[model samples]
Target: MFKVMTGKQAAELINDGDSVSINGFGSVSHPDEIDKAIEERFLDTGKPRDLTMIFASGQGHNKKGAYADRLGQEGLVKKVIGGHFALMPQIREMIARNKIQAYNLPQGVICHLFRACASNKPGILTKVGIHTFIDPRFGAGRLNEISKETWVELMELNGEEYLYYKTPRVNVAIVRGTTADPSGNITAEKESLIVDALHICQAAKANNGKVIVQVERLSTNPANPRQVIVPGVLVDAVVLAPDQKQTISEIYNPAYSGEIRMPHEQINRVIDEIREIDRRAGVAKERSYASMIIGRRAAQELRPGNVINLGVGLPEMVSIAAQERGTINDLIFTIEPGVIGGVPSVGGSFGASFNPDIIYSQASQFDFYDGGGLDIAYMGAMEVDQKGNVNVSRLGDKVIGVGGFVNITQSAKKVVYCFPFMGGGLDVKFDNGSLTIVREGRIEKFSKEVQQISFSGNYATKNQQPVLYVTERCVFSLTIGGLALIEIAPGIDLHRDILGKLPFQPIVSDQLKTMDMNCFTSP
Candidate 1:
C-alpha cells in the first residue's frame, strides 16, 4: 500500500500551498533528511511555495542555520502555526518582521488538536487558554500583524466559559521513526521520543493527505504488530535515512529509548556533560551563586511521593538542588513531551528522558496535565505584577509564546515561579548566610503590570490554587489580596533592596522570617 522512496523523492510529494504538520518535540524525532531534501528542492526548483507549516513543539537546535531555519525562506513558508519559537531563530525572525502569518498556541493544545483532527472533530473546547494570551479577549495567539485568521474563539457552555480552538487541515505530515518493515509499518523503538507522530499521521490520512515518514532502516520482514506505532495502512511513503541520530545532541543513547537503564553514577556524568555543552553554547548561564540560591529555595516546595514537572530554564535548577539535597529520587519527574518517572535530560536533549518509566503520546501526557495530575509545577518567569499574574510568553517586542506554561500553571495544585529579581546585569554575593546585592540589573522584572499574562492569577485564585514566587533575594506567596512578601534573605535591607525596587507596595507577612541559611551556602 505504501512505496519506499528517497528523501528527495518523498519531498516531491509535498505540493505548493499545502498545510504541513511536523511531528517532533524540539530537535528530537525530526525528519531532518526529508526536511533538508524539501529545502534543497525548493532552492533548486522553487516548487512547493507558500506552504503553511504547523508544529506542536518547536523543532531545531537553539542556533542559527539549523532545523526549521532551512525552510524559513521567503516563499517557502507563507505561514507558521506553532507552540514555541525561541529555538527557531530564522522562523522567529520572519514572524517578527511580519513577513509571514504567525500564530503561537499552547504546545499541549496543539498536540490535542492533532488527535481531534484525526477524528474529524470540528475543534477542541477547553479552559486551558482562558484568561491567557490565547483567549479571544486577549490577542488570540496572533504573533504578528499578518495573522488575521480567527482560529480561537470564546464560548460558554453550562454557565462556564471555554476557549474553542479550531482544527486546521493537515495536507501532509512529516514524521520519523527508527525502522520500517516491508509493509511500511513504523516502529519507534530506537527513537528518543514518540511525540505526536501517530496522531499527525492519522490526521493527514483522514483528510486524504500524504503521510511521509523518515526511518533509519527498512526491514525485509514484517514488523511485529505489538511494536508498530503507525500501521502500514496509515503510511503513504517511507524514506530511509540510515544515518539518523537519536536526537540532535547524541548519535544514539540506549537509555533515552528505554532500551537500557542508565546507572545513577553514569546519569550524573551525562548531566555534567550536558551542562558543559550548554555552558559552551551559551544556552544556559553558568550555575551561579544566585541561581543555586534560587534553586535551593524552590526545591524546598517539593514533597515526597509527589508528581512534579520542572520547566526548562531557571526552573531546571530546582532539580540540581533537589539532587544535592538527596531528595531527587523521592519525587517523580515529568516532562511536557510525555516522559514520566525518570531523570529529565537538559539542554538539547531536554524532551527525551534517561531511563524513563513510561513514554506516552504528547497528547495523552497533556491530558494528565490538564486533569490536575501534577502536584507542583516550577516554571521560569519573565515578569510578575501586582495582580500576581506572571508573564513568560511575550516581553516587549519578542513573542516567546506560552509553551505548556498555561496548562501546567493553571492546573497544578501548587505553582512555583523561579526567577531573578532583576534582569540584564545582576550581581550578588553571600557570606555567612547573609546575601548582598553587588550590582542591580537594568531591567526590573517585578512591575505594576506585565506585558503579557501567560498565567492568570485570578484564575488560579478562583480555583484556590496555591502559588509561590521564588527568587534569589526573597519569596512571595500569592494571597487573595495579591503578592504577599513571606520571606527575605538575611542582610538585605527591606527598604533599600526590596521595597525600593518594587513599583508597587506588597503586603508584608505578619510573621516574616529569614530564609534558611543553608540556601545561601553550598553543602
Candidate 2:
C-alpha cells in the first residue's frame, strides 16, 4: 500500500547526492507543487547538494524556468542529463557559464534509457544517432565543456555496428498525475498521455529506489481500470497536492492554443489596419510585415481533413491562422511528441499537453512517427544543403540536440520546411501588394554542406518522399540534381534574392511563378 502525504512532506524523502529521475515532457506532467517543495527545502535547509537529475522533457518548473534552473541557482544539482532545454533558459545559461554539467540527448533515447533501467538492462543499443553528434567518435555528445562525457560508444554485434547508450541507476523517481486511488493506482489521464508513469515507478523499484508521485487528488474508491495509468504494485508513496496546477493546455484553458474564432470581416479589418500602418511607413518590407504575411499564407494552407503537424518558431503562427480561418475544427493538429488533436504548448514547454484527445508515451509516439504515420509535417530548418539534408541539431559551437526532428522528418510523407530566405540580417518589402526585397539577413540557410545531417536526403530520395522548402522569398522542391526553385514571392528578383547568396548555382525552373498575392494582402 502507498501512503499519502502533502507535497512538502513528500519532498522530504529526498536526500543529498541522490540521483533523481523526473517524469515529464517539457511542462506537461511536471509536479509543480513537488518542485516548489524541493525549492523551499533547498531554501530552508540547504541540505541536498551535488544532486544529479534526469528528466525526459525540457527543463523548467512552470513557464518561468526549468527545475534545474532553481537547483542550479541554489547550487543543488551537480550534473543533469535529458533532452531539450528550451524552457530552461537559465539552465542553458548556467551550462554556458560552466556553472553546471548538462547533457542534451535524443528524446526517444532518453525514454529508452528509463525503460532499460526498468527491465534490468545494462544499457540500450540502437542506430538512432549514427553519424550525428551523439556518436562517440564525434565529441561524445558534448554540449559544453562541463557536459563533456563519453555516454555513447560504437560497438559491433552480429557483424553490425550499433551505438551503446548507458543510463545511471535511479535513486528516486518523481512523477505527477491526476489522481491516486486508495489502492495506489495513479491516473494521469488529464495530463500527457504519452508518459509511462508506471514504467518509471517500476524502474525505480527495480533499482531499489523510492517512487514519489504528486497527484491533484486522492480518490476513495478504486480508479476505473481503464483510467489507471500506473498500477498500485509499482507505487510506493502518493503525494496529495490539491493546489498543484495542471500543465497549461485546453484542459487548463483554451487560450493557450491562441485559437480564437473571429469573423472573417474582423480578421480582414485587422489586416487592413496593419497594412495602412506599413503604407504610412513607406516600407514594403516583409520583415516589418512577416507576421501578417506568414499568418495569411498559413491560413490558406489549412484545409479540411488535413492532419497537420506544426513545427516551432514561425510555423507555430499557422495555428493562429487556422483558427481565424475557421479551419481549426476541420484540421487535426499534432505536436512532435505523440500529442494528437490539441493545441501544442509553445516556447520551453514543447511536449504533450494535458488536454489532448489522445496521448501516447514518448516511446510509442516516436514509433508512430518513425514508422511514417503523419501525412504532412511542417518543420523549421536552420539550414538546408543542396542535397536537401536539413541541419537542425547542431550549429557550430551550439548543440540543440535532435529531439524528435529526425524521426518526424524522416517519417512524414510530405515534409514542408518553412523558413526565411535569408537569416542574420535580412529585410523585405511589398509594393502594391507585391513583395520586394529591401534588406537581407546575413546567415545562409542553403549551405554548401550542413553542420550535421539530421534528415538524410538519401533516405527521402530512396523513399520517394515529397519535400518542399518554403521560404519568405521562394519555394523549392527536392530534385535529383539539387533544390529546384518552383516559386518566388511576388516582386522578388531571381538574381538578387535567389542567385546572389548561394555558394553554388541552383536549378531554376522556367515554370516558376510568383507566390500568392493574397499572401501579402491584408487578411
Candidate 3:
C-alpha cells in the first residue's frame, strides 16, 4: 500500500544513517521539493544524521540549491558515493578537506549496481574499471584519505578477471515523476529524461527500504497501466509538488519533454543563451587557436554514417568544426543522457537534445555504450603521461569523476583526444599554409607520469585500438612503442616547438608527416 502526502511529510522517512540513492542526471529529474524538505527537516530538528548518499550521476541546480551539498553542508551525510560531483562545490570542499568519506565510481557501474541490487545479486562484476582509478589495484574508487571502506575488489571467476562492485544497502530512494494516480501509479512522461527511476525504486524495495517519490500532480482518475513507470505496489510514498519545475534550473519547456518540436533555427538561440550563461559562470571556452586547430583535425576523423560521441571541452568544438566542413549530415552525434542523432545541447540543457531522432531511457543508452555501439569518441585531455594514459577524470585534488568517459572511450573503436602541448598562455599564428607558435603555456600537459590514468594507453596497445592525440602543433598516435609522434605543424620546429616543449621524449616515426595545409587556410 502507498500513501499520497505533502513533500514535508514524505521527507520524514529519511532516517538517520540511511543509505540514500537519488535518481537524476545533472539538474534534471531531481526530487527538488522533497530534497529541500529533507534539508529543512534537518535544519529544524537535525534528526537525520550520518547518512550515506549515493547517486549514479550529478543532481543539483547549482551551488546554492544542490541537494547533495545541503546534506554535506548540514553534516547530514557521513559518506558519499557518486558518479560525478564537480558541480557540487560545497560537497567537493567537504571531500577535499576530508570532512566526509567520499568515493567516485563509474556512472555506468553505479547505475548497473542498482540492477544488481534489484536482482538480489551480491554485486556487479565487469571489466570497465580495469587499469583505471576505480580498479582495486588503484585506490579502489576512494576519492579522499578518509574513504577507508573498500566497496570494490578484484575478482576472477574461471579464466576471466573482473572488478566486482560490492552493493551497498540502499535504505531510501528519492525519485521524481510527472503524475501519480490514486493507486500511486507513476508516470515519467513529462520528464526531460527518465534516468534509472525504475531501478532506483526497485533497488530500495529489494532492500525493504522506503521509497519517496516527488510528483507534479496527482491524477483524479486512474492512470493507464502503460503510463506507469513504477507500479503502485512498489512505491511507499508520493509527494505532490504543485509548483515543481521541469528541472530545477528550468521551468516548464515543451522542447525538453518532447511535447513540441524545437525549430532547428531556434536551437542556435538556445545555444547562444547557454554559452552566455556559461561565460558568466566562468566555464565558457574562448575558442583558442589551439582548440580550433584540434577541433578541425579531430572532425576529419569522422566518416559518413558513423555513430560518434563528442565529449565536453575541446571535443565539443568538433561538432562546430564538422558543421563548418559541411559534414554534419555525414555522421550521428550522441550524448550519454540517451539523446541520439540530435544536436546535443550544452550547459543547463546538455542532457537533453534539440529535435532528437530518438530518446531512450538512460539504461538503454548505457546498454548501447557497454555493448560497444559507439564507433568513435572524442574526449578532452587534462594530462597524458609517457605511457599514453590520459587523465581527464582527475587533476590534483579536483575530482572530475569519470562520468561516462570510461564507458564511451573504452568501448569506442577509435578514440581521439583533443588537447594542447603546454598549459599556459599558448599563442599561435597562421601564415599562408603554416602555423607558428608566438608564445607557449608554462604548464606541462605531457608528463613523465600523469596524476591519474583515466584511459589506459597500455589497454589500447593490447587491444590494438587506434587512438590519436591531436594538438595545435603536433599529433601523436598509440603504437606498440608508446606515443608515436606521427605528424607536426608545418611552420613549427620539431625540436623547439614540439619535442623540446614536451617533458618527456616521444617516439618519432621515420616517415613523420606534416599536417594538412587546409587546416590552417580554412575559412
Candidate 4:
C-alpha cells in the first residue's frame, strides 16, 4: 500500500511505446535521479523502448544532466516533442543522424497544451504559431525530415489563425520537488525553480496514468497543508533522493526556492559564478564595445518599475549593462523559467537565481505574458529581414524551437531585438568616442529575408506595437515603411559600413542621427 518506491520501481512502470512527460525548464526542477534510474533501466533491460518523451524547454542548462538526452542516447525515447535542443547537443547529434523521431514545438504552446491534457479537453487552439513553421502548410511543429507526423494543425476560427496542437494523454508523469509527506503531498521548498510540476502531475492522472514524483526528503510531520502543490490523492509513486541538488551546478540554496530572502552577499554569488565561467572561457570581464553599445542603447528603453522580460543571447547583455549601470534592481526582471524580480543568471544557469524575490509555475508566468502584463521584452535575434521579421530559432540544421520567444515578443507592449550587426567573428573597437569596425564578420545578420519569421514585424505593426532593432553599429525601428535606420554609431560610415554591407537596403531616416557617444564609453 506504500506509494514510496525506488526510482527503478518507478521506471519499471514505463513500457514500450508509452508517452511520458518529464517536468523541467532550462534544466532546473527536473527529476534527474529518477531520470538516471530510467536510463539505467533502459541500458540494463531495454524494456521501455521507443517511448514518446515530452518536455517543454531545454532539459539541462548545459550538456551534462540532460535527462532527455540520456534517454534518447540510450535508445529509450523514440520521439521527442519539446521546445529546445540547444542544450542537449549529444541528443541533438542523434536527431541529426535521424536516430529518433523528434518534433520541436514552441515552449508556451506545449506548456499550455499540458493544461488541456490535464482537463481531458479535446485539444489546444491558440494563436501562437500561426504563419511560420507550426502551421500545417509548413511543417506543423515537425523538426526534421525524420519527424513526419504532424501533431499541430492550422485551423481558422472567426477569421483568426490558430495552431491546434493535438494532445496525447500523458501515460506517465515524472516530476521532482524538495519534500513529501507519508501520503506524498509535494512541496518545492528547495528547488531552484518551480516549473510546471502541478500540471505535469495532473496531465498524467487525467489519463488514468501513474504520477511518480521525486522528492529530496520525507517530512515526518507532513508538509504544511497550505504548501501542498500536489495533493496525496493524485500521486501514485514517490521516489526519494536525500541528496538532490537544487540544480546541476549547485547543491542547495534556500534563497532559490523563495523560502527566505537572502542578503546582498548571497545574491551576488550567482554573479560571481558567472564571472568565473567567463574567466574559464577566456572572455574578458568587459564585453566588446559593439555589445556594450547595443546593450546601452537597448537599456534606454527601460523605465523604472516596469515588469520587463528578457530573452537569451545578446539581449542578455541588457541585464549586464543594467547591472554595470547599477539600475538592474530599479525595474522588475523576469525570465521564462519562472524566476521573478532577480538579476537572472545568464548562460548555463539560465533558469536559477541567487536572490529571486519569488518563483512561480512557468505556466502562470506565461499566462501573465499572454495576458499582456509585460511592459517590454528584449530578445536576441539571429537575423532581421528587410520586412523587419526577426529569426532566432532557425539556422543550418538546428531547429531551436521558439522557447518563450513568440509568447513574449507577440504580447509585450514594446519589443527590442538586441544583437550585433553581424556575426561570425565581427569585431569592433572604440577610442575617444570614435567607433571602428576592426573586423567584418563573414556572415551578415540583416539579410534580404530571414530563414524563418519567428517574430513577425507585420504582426507587431498590425497590433500597433513598437519594435526596436538595437545593433552595435546602428539602431533601427520598425516603421510602416519597414526597417528605418534611425541612428548610426559615431565614426562609422553610413554608406560603406552600414549600407554597403547590408544584404537588403533599409529605409533611410531623414532625421538619422549619430549614436550617443556614451554608449562606446564606460557605464
What are the models' TM-scores? 0.98, 0.81, 0.95, 0.95
Candidate 2 C-alpha lDDT tens digits along 159-209 = 977789897677788887888888888886455444646667777888888
How much lDDT does each candidate structure score?
0.89, 0.70, 0.82, 0.80
Pitting candidate 2 against candidate 3, the one with the higher lDDT is 3
Encode model 4's per-residue lDDT on 1-523: one tens digit a residue: 3388899999898888888988887657778888888888988887788888888877864454466567765467778888887767666766777888888777887788788899988788777766666667766767677888879887878987777888866878888888888777898877877787888789988888888889988888778987777887888889988887766556776666767777766666766776677557554245566777888889888888889988776777787678778788798888786777866765545687756877888888888888898999999888889888888877867656677888888889899999888887789988877788899887778888888777888778878899999988899999877899999988899999999988878999999998887677775
Scored against the true structure, residue 108 in model 4 reaches a CA lDDT of 80
Q: Which candidate has the top score in TM-score?
A: 1
After superposition on all CA atoms, what RMSD does each candidate show versus the true structure? Answer: 1.2, 5.8, 2.0, 2.2
TM-score of candidate 3 on Cα atoms, chains taken together? 0.95
Report the C-alpha lDDT of model 3 over 303-388, residue by residue, as the tens digit: 99999998877788888788789888788888786678767777666677666677666767878988889999999899998889
Residue lDDT tens for model 1, 1-523? 9999998999999999999998888788888898799999999999889999988887887687577668888899999888888778788888889999999889999999999889999999999989988898988999888889988999999999999999988879999998899888999998878889999999998889999999999999988898898888999999988998887777888999999999989999998887787778777666667888999999998889989999888888898899899998998999998889889988878888888998879999999999999999999999999889999987766767788888889989999999998877888999766799998888898989888889888888888999999988999999889999999999989999999999999999999989988888766
Best by lDDT: 1
Q: lDDT at 318 for candidate 3?
A: 88
Q: What is the clash count for each candidate, in the order shown?
A: 0, 18, 1, 0
